[model samples]
Target: MTSADVTRPSPGRETPATAAWRPSRVVTVPPAVPPVTTGTLADLVLDWEREDPGAVCFSRRDATGAWRTAGVAEFAARAREVAAGLVAAGVRPGDRVGLVSRTRYEWTVVDAACWFAGAVSVPVYDTSSPEQVAWVLSDSGAVVCVVETAAHAAVLEDVRAQVPALRHSWVIDDGGLDELVAAGRGVGEDALRAARAGSGPGTTATIVYTSGSTGRPKGCVLTHGNFVDLAANAHAVMPDMLDEPGASTLLFIPLAHVLARFVEVLCLSVRIPLAFAPDSRELVADLQSFRPSFVLAVPRVFQKVHAAAGHKAASGGRVRAALFARAEATAVAYSRALDAGGPGARLRAQHAVFDRLVYGKLRATLGGRLTRAVSGGASLGEHLGHFFRGVGLTVFEGWGLTETAAPACVTRPGDLRIGTVGLPLPGTEVGLAEDGEVLVRGIGVFREYLNRPEETAAAFRDGWFRTGDLGSLDEVGNLSITGRAKEIVVTAAGKNVAPAPLEDRLRTHPLISQAVVVGDERPYVACLLTLDEQALAAWGQLHGRPGLDLATAAGDAAVQAELQRAVDSANTSVSRAESIRRFRVLGQDLSLENGCLTPSLKVRRSEVLRVFAADLEALYR
Candidate 1:
């Protein structure tokens, strides 16, 4: 974790792009930190205990809603005890164990314990249904499963007969971990060391299932070297953020996600004190209490925060609302100025005034300490990125998928590219296929999709792994994702269109929650829209239509006019043939509960097209 560890590009290595006009097709960054050759992930815990025994490594909320800290020595001791329990229970090296839970301190302990015991940890989402649990457990052949509650256990019980390999299940809420610790008292330290020594950097560390936004979830085989090497390289490339004085982060994203899981190991490697928000409902309250210096979240979370601030200002009366609007414009302008030299004196003065009024309050809402964040899972709108930076919070947007073990490319705070996903990390190579498909090759990429040899072979061509995403690299190697190749729409006239740009622009409007543009095999492009409940309510109250229901609002002329204006603005970004021609507003928002969105907040386009087939047909009619 020092500047000396970073490796610059070798002499004569061609830069990815350099033309003053068009972008390039390939980008490669040399390894910032050398790949780990011998040690396993378990060695990270052992090193922490031996070197920084008393350093705080994690924090958790107590029963009374207060923050509590745990040091490296204690964390390691707990993990060793749990590892002994697994060894005593007939678990051996390479055995698969299931972990089903929300983001919490215990999840990390169990994860480390699994590594220490030379077992492969399989993470199942806490919100998974019985069928999903069965599919993952059966597919991975997990022998032991740990669940957070009785409800989660019940779901497992419903499909226990289907998973013949499962031998035991434990409930965290009922003190299952304590019982295991008590049962392992007789196991000697020699056995624990032997178990840990069985694994190396090449050994399998975990099998994480995909979010299944399109089809059945697949188990991805991630080796210990993937985490170890990627963590070192990521830290080396972004030392400014990861090595900042008193740097710490609160992780609210599900542990089952590759991004959050990677951050878990990165925090431990860099000795950054990490905290978790088990329940998203209490995230705001927890932020106030924990006061973390940084955070990791998806783009939707930022959108909600901005929407909430706008709603709050509108509630404070018309004059306050107008002032807030002016302040917001000043902030965006101020941030844009930073890219073009610096802000003018008058603009800087205006920003200074807003810092005392609007900006400070916005920062305080996310815990007064938050100065940096890492956004992924989807493209964060350019305006939101600039707005946050203007208000004193800098968000670094990154891009990657489950196959790449989290981020392969990330924006650097020092260079500050507002629109693009950013440069490839050290040791990562990004290129485009002839058809514009994104290809990746790096230490972070997964070895294979578990138990799918045919599929695994198909996933890689020559050397790079196909990402199924389309993107472009700028003149300086910054990557900007355009859309998903499989999700592209084609009209009857054979004109191709990417729906992502239109959808992203529409979602930026306060009244719009989700948008799906459709025109495949049809005469023209059309769209299906869902209104944001919170924003709609505020808009209704301001227009003398308080307590308006969604059905009534859908037909209201004023609401229709506002949405049309938004649609018109979005259309300006593309050609007339690609622009949305007609639209139908849905009666409700597309959400995870409604089966229109996935656990990672990505829209299930196929599901949307199926459920709203009639609405789409009406647009053409």
Candidate 2:
């Protein structure tokens, strides 16, 4: 069947918008899944263990580069042992346990063990500062924190006295897992089972903190039922991506993020083997070694991959660079034609030729086995989506929040729409407010924001959880996100503009790395641009300049001219009022360490504006 056939929802019922001012009606797409009444995530794991005791559950690479595999029974046993340790350490039912680490095997074991011990897991990003670490620990009242390395332990230790609730911290790199298991050896299996049994649908599973672009992070309270519903519906919608017996995923995204956490649980529920890459810098090598069937990453990862591939080809030689350019154009054309209906005869022939000559090599870089990929956390540019599809990798872009337990709406395998985030997952309802703000209501929605009842109440209008994202739904129920409600810039003339689409477009340029559009309360729209260092250096070499640094390049007339072309191209997609009339290239790129970008690589607009206030003002002057 075609993508249109897969995305078109059966018309049976309609959900009316709650607000009188809302012109867009609610879109309710019936779930493809049967009713899931799983009591807790632990129960789902146990069920899988009973059904397939010998099924390989996880594959982790050791320090020596050797791959270690674990089966369902083995992982469950280890989780129980870890749960016993938590219990032995005074982790009673309903206690809050904090996990601070990069994505790793131990993190998953500790998470499952928390559920097994009837404690709630609270994840803090590994890159968080000591102050942020203390704030999350104090706010969540997490009693025990498990850290990955001595460095992570040190960060927590610096603020340990400030957080009285954090009684103990364990470093996984220092044999913490073995020590915990040994400490709990006396604890019986029956006690662990009892802890798991105490959990129900409403029981709190995790407290994931928001990235806090604007202010302090707030804890989102997600329940066991929330995760179960999301995983079931997500798997139901994309069975081919998850349900096959040999389906596996190499998860490299931060588990602190709800999206990666959901993938972790979903893999367990469907008996799919899950693997973790220790460092994102090694993700390419890991993908080559593991050769996973599917992968999940943020848009930034895809963008980097696309850029790296282009740079590699261009650096090879003139002949190779020309072939790469022709291949990219052909791929975009072929994928766009398929989206329209199907490729014409000539387009199909051209695609087949590229499939052997160009696309196959590109696919090989991703291990030559990735059937599909999922991009979330931010919007994936439509150009990249189409290009990837042309190269034989279909990326299904999804949309959700930390509050939705990861995914509320996602594009299914064959239902790929390049721009839209596809249809809402089964059992979820999406509505657009009068002003085009997206509203979501479903079982996957979080119960509340921890210790913030007023804020929680404000988050919901009537029953629907206000997503604070602006978007619209097509007649067929596909969702297209415009921008965050709070991020929309209101020009001095009163015209509102969404910067995401423009920023996304500009980043696609070879030279542009990051773009932040600013025009709030100003006469016209302007932008702060950051150059892609590698791309710029390569461009400079191809031209005349060489050995160029970012500072020098930022002021160079030639560099400014190239940026102007990119800005003009981006402006073509929007109206004059919304277009960026001018831009200033910043000498330094925004980075996580610099506090200008979030750990997920999302630009912190407030922080950017604060840091570049003078540059922005000079543009208008």
* lDDT per residue (tens digit) for residues 1-621 in model 2: 112222222221222544333325677666666545547888877899898889898999976997899998999999999999999999988999999999998999999999899999999999999999999999999999999999998888889988897777789999898989999999998988787777887789999999998788999999988887778778888888776657788999999999999999888877789998869999899999899999989999999988887777766666777788889999999989987888899988988998898899888988888969999999998999999999989999999999888888888776677899988888777888788888887767888899999999998876678899999877678899999999999999999999999999999887888999999999999999998888777777766787776978978899889889989999999999999999998889999977998877788999998888888889899
Q: After superposition, how far is residue 524 of candidate 2 from its true place, in Å?
A: 1.0
Candidate 1: regions farther than 4 A off: 1-24
TM-score of 1: 0.95
Off by over 4 Å in 2: 1-23
CA RMSD of each candidate after superposition: 4.0, 3.2
lDDT of 1 by residue, 1-621 (tens): 112122233211123333232112667787877888898888888888899899999999999888889999999999888888888887888999999999999999889989888999999988888888999999999999989999999999999998999998888999988977887788888888788686887799999999998899999998898888889988987787889889889999999999999999999888899998999888888888888899989998998888888888876767777787888889899999999999999999999999999999988888899999989998997888888999999999999998888998999868989889998888788877787888877788888899899988898765568898998877787889999988899999899999988998898887888999999999999999999887788878777888866888889999999999999999999999999999999988898778898777889999999898889889988
Sliding window of 10 residues with minimal summed lDDT for model 1? 4-13
Among these predicted structures, which one has the highest lDDT? 1
lDDT of 1 at 49: 84
How much does candidate 2 score in TM-score? Answer: 0.95
